[model samples]
Target: MEEKQMDLVSLLLRPELPNVQKELPTARYRVKRLSELLDTDVVFTLKGLPYGKVQKLRESMSDDVSVQILLQGCVEPNLKDPVLKEHYGGATPAETVKAMLLPGEIEDLSRAVERLCGYRKLTIEEVKNA
Candidate 1:
């Protein structure tokens, strides 16, 4: 009798298979206007927010969602830093973000963070399952 080939489903179900998960991704964005204001490059490092946090932000529907996202996702120019907060004359991280960034800049950074978190509009073909 010949042995049968194991299918993908069977292979995946094998208990011995090591669980391999990739780390969350990060990206850097340069705010040109800010850089110009500072007379140097003002680049910010941002990481993807976890699904739970993103879901909570969505459900809250707060006006400061963008600021909240920046506070959570920005790894560089640390928005939560005490010095930055002082410089911005903001008492909280969210206030610092609002004071430091223009409305359009906040929106742009929020969109960038969302992209890193795997949010994007599906193409028509993709929506059709092509």
Candidate 2:
């Protein structure tokens, strides 16, 4: 019989305050990629000799992309819809994201990017510094 050594401890998992002194300066802005949004099921015409059809199709398509939008704390309810109609012209949010959407106001770019990326937001101070 082999004896097993166990090292067990209990901990109260809680959020910790960041130590500003040890952390990076406030000028740094966290960046994220554009693909973090909706998941897509891309269909590609792969070239293979299975049943030996003609050459595979050269196009790729994906119509099954799932999206979950959380407008709260993001969009200003009072903001006129005409603003959206101006640039996007009723295009789907996914399309707007693919197009690297920017807000009408320069000051709102961070909020716009945050909504678009759905993960992080930039700061105006950091933007100006950069």
What are the per-model numbers of colliding residue pairs? 0, 0
lDDT of each: 0.83, 0.28
- The residue-level lDDT of candidate 1 at 45 comes to 94
TM-score of each: 0.77, 0.21
Q: Report the lDDT tens digits of candidate 2 across residue range 1-130.
A: 1222222111222335433234312111222222234353221111111111111211222231211121211233212344554576546544443234333222233333233332244434443534
Question: Which portions of model 1 show Cα errors greater than 4 Å?
Answer: 1-22, 121-130
Which segments of model 2 are wrong by more than 4 Å?
Answer: 1-9, 12-82, 101-130
Return the top candidate by lDDT. 1
Clash list (residue pairs), candidate 2: none
